[model samples]
Target: MNRIYLPLAASLVLIVSLALVEGKMRDRWGTPGVEAAELGKRFDQVPKKIGDWVGEDLPVEEVTRKTAGAVNYVSRLYTNSKNRNTVNLWLIIGHSRDVCRHTPTVCYPSQGFRQTGDPLKHHIDVLGEEPAEFFTATFSKEDPSGRHLERVFWAWNHPNTDIWEAPDNARVHYGLSRALYKLYFVGNVLNDENTIDSSASVDFAKLMLPALNAALFPEKIADTVQSDIQPAGDAPAEEVPAE
Candidate 1:
């Protein structure tokens, strides 16, 4: 009877310990229970006219859309009338933080493009908005037909203040909370003489980021507008060099 009681007591203790650990983990890393469908935004409302550039919605392929695993996304091409330089915009609100790995680093390589170099980090201060941090990469693919070079800039945005390229940061900020957002800008310089000029992406972000912020955080727009008028010392500043 003593042996039986001792075994039962030990088993009960183990169960209780496991339960406590599970609870703590859930508190620290649990994803929100909200469905992605419920968080869809009206990307259709993004203005076609952003500054001097005009945008047109582009169709995302069925296979690509399904592979993205985003609850919703917006794909568009914006071209400046002055220079006719074009940039492609893609904003995705993923179904889960797992989408962090869906960056061009993986996708482009899989699609047959070889990555050219390490991703470059950049910060741009958009007027009337907080500084945005992003990563840029260039990919080149050669085939029997020809070679193609594409440059992509992207970031993970949070509802709160921080924006960065670190996946762990995004996981902690949005994955734990079960809300994730990502912005991507891609430009094809396949035919251009300057294949390394990445400024087109920056220029597009400058004009379109405001609309993106409004869509993602409509409640924060009034506060953002107020900040847009703040004095220089206290205001968010741009670190990007002039092109």
Candidate 2:
């Protein structure tokens, strides 16, 4: 009788401790100034034209959208004007728990695609800011038509920080955030490409980062200066011309 009651009491204590930790985490990370709906609206402002890539909206099925659990999302195809290569962009914002669970690794397999190799972490240099990090993976599907290959790069960032990261566990990493944004750049692989460094998706990301930052965090953009203009007293005196 003593042994049975002791084990049960310990189990209850463990359960309650876990609950308290979760509650504190939520209180710290889930309190953003902007609501999820308001942040979702900003997705509309992300440009349709970024550098040489011209974009057009892609229709997302109602059921598919609901399944993703995104409060807001944008699915579009951006085509390069010169090379004619195309990359698909999917951006979503929602609760971290919902947004983080459905990564390409999970969804692609469910759709009959097989992972080709272990995912790799890739970094993209975003001008005027720190290099953005993403996880890249390749998947292939076989159908009657033939084999189809896709390379996908994905990352998540909090609205306030605007710093993209590829975490080993996004759900746990962002569990406290009020809302989270997830971005994906998917491009078709042609001719069994060996490297993703030169992929159109990567090139497009380089051009898209600044535009995305401007749209999603306009206030931050306003605070940054593109030029090197110095304050009145900060400028050095000009030298007079010698006769």
Candidate 3:
């Protein structure tokens, strides 16, 4: 009887864990800012093209904050984090307690960073919908040392749907997401904060451009073979000049 009950209890524990994860993902549909319900409307529209979305730019406070290896260019009143190594991960880019100022009420949507360890969990932060000027404002590495500088673009959209389940364009957008994820992993290996020139991100942008542009992207993991990326011996640090 005791042995049988142990198995039943273990199964129940697994079920509970899965349920919590599922619930968290469901909670974060799009970027979370102020405009939650309104953003949901446009986000659910089934995107046509990248340009079709992220149209223009509205007024934001333009705040900057530094973390251990990452810096967030965000609005002052609209961001927070509880990760130990997160450093100061959110840069506030807006004033008046809002990330999006044009709306004067709703918050601008900002998306990215699925629940820490859960890549599938997407959190939606929104401001407004129509007359919405969405621009890809990227943040550069605030600290140069011990960081692999990489740029991250943000916008508010529902995270409920899996980009893997979306159309080709979704994969394209996800390609960028994957690129960012890779940079993060590599940054950890190199023990450096990833930084990029705001205007010159297009250079590193090519890192994942192929997949983003490809209609049928490869499902396999890239660079499976360990080749030249590894260092042979202890040598001088590789100094990469600005692109």
Best by TM-score: 2
lDDT of 1 by residue, 51-125 (tens): 888988888888787787666788888888998888888887654445565888889999999999998877766
Weakest 10 consecutive residues, lDDT, candidate 1? 24-33
> Model 2, residue 161: what's the lDDT?
83
* Residues 32-110 of candidate 3: C-alpha lDDT, one tens digit per residue: 3333323223222221223211212223332412211111221211111222121111222111112222220111123
Off by over 4 Å in 3: 28-243
For candidate 2, the per-residue lDDT at 50 reads 79
By TM-score, rank the candidates, best first: 2, 1, 3
Candidate 2, residue 168: the lDDT equals: 93
TM-score of each: 0.72, 0.81, 0.19
Give the residue spans of candidate 1 off by over 4 A: 1-35, 160-173, 190-198, 224-243
- lDDT value for model 2: 0.86
